[model samples]
Target: MHNAINESYLGERYSEWSLDSDSTIETPNKNQAPWGLENISPIFRAYENSIWQNHVAAMWSHLEARYNITSNDSCGTHVHISLIEGYSLSALKRICQSIIYFEPAFEAILPRARLGNEYARSNWLDNPNFGYKRLSRRESMVVIEKCTSVRELVLLTPTTISSLGGISSISLKPLKEPLNFVVVQQARLSAMSLYKISKIPATVGGLKWFIEAAQLPQQPGLFDTRYINLLLDSVGPKLTREPKPMGKLSPDKLRKLQTKKDEDKRKNVMLAKISQPPYWG
Candidate 1:
């Protein structure tokens, strides 16, 4: 059951990348390169939001083709490479790394919660239900302790943990001070979105593994499926077959571009007004 759950999670991860990549190609003008300064445009309202947008763009660009090539699915969802037989270990590691890098703000919130626990602090500990097996009690405790506060810890822990083994029981102790409800809510929402975006690249990485594992012939499958599709779907029909050499923009064309930019700015301002967060006293 535990393995199955993990597999399901990985599959979802892949699916997210698939969707994100599809969205990017379908919205190329909005799909700026990862870490690109263009993210500061009015379309992305905040730094974190911009980061999430770009991460999704990058991730989708990475994974789309790989999965399409393998064309494998577990259940109804596309079978992410991480869930493919024999691909879990490395896939898990890569997924972890991507989460850390692209979602640092969310990552920053976890260690704060773990510091309040006693059992989590101890050096020597046993999984009592598992017959006293040595556990990474200290390491786990350290991770928790390093968290800045309780809110951070809550954000870090998985939403659910299911045991495939014998009966599992756990206890929770109240924090000295509960996390700020509003802040917690915002952080949770942002973290959830970030997690969603990070899944794209990880899914692509997983698909790459699957292709290799299956000993399929190397070709343009990865780019052809994910990136090209994204570009075609989003950017509309390819306007030209041959690459045109760069040329200076004529004054008339430049003026038209500037006008479009100004219009975009006005539209964004209006949208922002409509979507402004509610205020309360």
Candidate 2:
């Protein structure tokens, strides 16, 4: 199948979506409110819009109850983008190389506090000077996977990652979601794991997949249940849930402000170190 880049699609590194309990919004939108995952501590799912949407709130509430989520389950958003015919493996490699070429820009922007600790600290690389480059390696992992006879690139990791890390975390497969690393609930984790797998019937929404194997054993009333196992549901997109772009800051303005903030922080830290005395007086 021929695939091309949808100009509308954005390649951006967005901020961590804040989860507010007393959110007055009624619906979920793309920018005013975008959905994100935060299963770790303070386990609560917040709405992404000024108004709450039908499916999102109810669905997340159901999940929260069934899964005993805790603070430890917290995870940073690791977006995965599928590379189709237009964006083949070779294209991804070029992107990776570009990031490596502009490694300083990445290091200049990403705060040090976000790196080197434990949870998400440090890229696959450990050194601050070069470790930042690892961030670009994540996207390099995107590769083509064939399910049945269909073939496509399954992108589950960032366009950049550490040198050692492979496809970031989730184990990509044709029939199922990547192997889940976030343990929302130990006992119920097995069931939650199915959410990411393409084999299960998609429930919530976003983009999803459905199998049409005419050859699979069909159970027409009299026959037993064989196709039931094949039923799978993945998340798909909902226009109603997205926020309108009526009121928003310009992207260029936002980038400039964010850059200044980050740069100022780095500058202050450097000056402080130079002025402060050594521990051994």
Candidate 3:
């Protein structure tokens, strides 16, 4: 299948497709990769396009035309959203609240196969970790609404275990929405944790070390540029770059102005630091 895909019209792009052990998709060929996992799942790398017609739709059409592909109970689609500005805390809280309120409506439209599926378990289900079963509708709203931080929100949400025995705080599977709450919620949790810890320097470089220290799950693909888990990490480096000037200013004048601004900012910071009440030993 690897050779077949690479030699096709879209072969160049097909190079990214690799076999995944987790995939349950049946394949005729039993030829195993060096790792000894079954060569059934030909997973595509994460891709983004401004226009869906040009990229994903075209690829799907090409594959369907050339290959004798058939869908079964195991086959389902997942759509990942990569926000340009990333998600704000208030937005995430509101989203969770909406999902909680309208989950029944969402389940009503989905195929029977998706329901009770281990991959994407409904967050509203009864779990010992979260006692949502006994709560009234208004009480449930209060529970999620009262969550002050990402960590609090995550604690309130339910989690699923992966087939590989890993705790999937964020399940990759979503029926139509394809939304993974755990990934975003966890990322925000880490960011908030970093902010609270005075020992960890408040910078992008400090995040990796802090994650290691905190013993947070460090899945290989989960923290990549494609995932929202690194949204905060990705933005930190970009913030250091100088902004493009919109107003008229000569290069020399701009340099002098920047220097003056920097000095003033430093002075203000120092003054603020000194203004803090002295701690009693």
lDDT to native, each model:
0.26, 0.27, 0.38
Worst 10 residues of 2 by lDDT: 180-189
Q: What ranking of all candidate models by TM-score puts the best one first?
A: 3, 2, 1
For candidate 2, the lDDT comes to: 0.27
Ranking by lDDT: 3, 2, 1
| Worst window of 10 by summed lDDT in candidate 1 | 72-81
Count of steric clashes across candidates, in order: 15, 46, 0
TM-scores of the candidates are 0.17, 0.23, 0.43
Cα TM-score of candidate 2: 0.23
- Candidate 3 structure quality by residue, lDDT tens digits, 146-257: 7788776666664422121112222233222212233433443444321144454424444334344444453433432223333334344212211111224468556654
lDDT of 1 by residue, 1-281 (tens): 01211012222221122111211011224545331111111112222112323443454355454533221111011100111133232232232222322222221221333221221211122223111343342333334335554455444332111111000111112211211122211222233222344343323233233223334222231212233123223322212111111134568555654664554444333233224331111
Residue lDDT tens for model 2, 186-253 = 11112211223323322222111111221222223211222222221221222111111112336854
Candidate achieving higher lDDT, 2 or 3: 3
Clashes of 1: 15
Least well predicted 10-residue stretch by lDDT in candidate 3: 160-169
